[model samples]
Target: MTPKLELRGVAKAFGEKGSPTRVTAVRDLSFTVAAGELVAVVGPSGCGKSTILNMVSGLYGPSEGAVLIDGAEVKGPRSEVGFMLQKDLLLPWRTVIENVEFGLETRKLPKAERRRIARAELRRIRLEEFADSYPYQLSGGMRQRVALARTLAISPELVLLDEPFSALDAQTKLVLQKSFSRTLSESGLSCLLITHDLQEAVIMSDRVVVLSGRPGTVVDTFAVDLPHRDDPLARSTLPATQAYVKRLFDTLHIAEGAA
Candidate 1:
């Protein structure tokens, strides 16, 4: 089967060609996310982790090579891709359900149908009780849950997550990680997550891709063989999980502070 997503010899550069100020964010970066798999990317700051997601999401085009979804090139954003960031980014004026319904609204879905879909997503995340609450009324974790619900409401086949739980406290981050892992598994959605936390990568992903610093390129890839992938919290505590984390730390040279 074709991979859910593929980046072939992808490179992205900013500024005009041959210009002194030109910078390359990533180079010769290649990877794949298999269907129903979750892949996490970790690297030093400015390694273009988010740049890869933007290319996949079609927010920006790679200067060299190509991005393909299920064998076809991605020229621009498509309905089948969903993106979530570290911030909840919920509209303060909209209630929880209404916020979830925002994407559906943009698609011009019927109001009743939109409500039905949003409500179901809210229920899936176990936030149905807060459907009528505003963003300010919910805790940080709850708001992120709402953000997740909104991302899923459109039923995208693949979700690109950029540190979606980094803002939460340790306990809350674990809870949200478990929730997201379970949801992705049950829904059979493919995901590409960019995070700085190696532990988070090991606990949440089936495979972890490490990138080099600046002009990011694939340095190494590790397969996470922990049991119960859907329960990231449990996975995090396992000795095997720490082993993977340590391996990642080693690959990234976290202790050496290599630039």
Candidate 2:
């Protein structure tokens, strides 16, 4: 079966070709995320982790190779892909339900229908009581949960997460991680997550892909065999989980040292 997302020998470069100032961010990178599989990418800073997401989301075209979704080449922004960033990026003016409905609204969904969908998503995140609350009215973790509701309202086939929980406090981060992991697993959404946190990668993903430094390329990919994937808190405390984390750390260290 075709993978849900595929990056075939992908490379990205900035600045004009042959120009002295040109810089290649990632090169000869290849990976795949299968349907309903969550893949985490871990690498040192400046390894072009975010660059790869941009290419996959069609925000930027690859300088070489290709990005494909469901066997089709991605030439531009795709409706089947949803992206979430470190920041919530919620509209301050909109209420919780309204923020969740933003994407549906863009699709020209009828008001009642969009409202219904948004409400259901908010309920899923257990923020139904805050339907009328604005982003400023919620805590950091709540705001991110609202952001997640917004992302899922569209029912995208693939979700690209760029350090989505990196900003929260430690305790909040763990709670949100478990919640989000359960949500993703239940939704069966294919995900490609870019994160610096090795433990996060190990706990929340089916597999972890490590990249080398600048002009990033895949150095290694490890399958996570721990149980209770949806319950990240439980997974995090396991010796198996710590073992995976250590392996990821060593891989990253080696990659950085070689760079």
**TM-score, every prediction:** 0.97, 0.98
For model 1, residues 118-161, the per-residue Cα lDDT tens digits are 99999999999999999999999999999999999999999999
Candidate 2: tens digits of C-alpha lDDT, residues 1-259: 9999999999999999999999999999999999999999999999999999999999989999999999899999998899999999999999999999998877867899999999999999999999998899899999999999999999999999999999999999999999999999999999999999998999999999999999799999978998987999888889888889989888888888899
After superposing candidate 1 on the true structure, give the runs of residues whose Cα lies further than 4 Å from its correct spot.
254-259
Model 2 misplaced stretches (Cα beyond 4 Å) = none
Number of the top-ranking candidate, with TM-score as the measure: 2
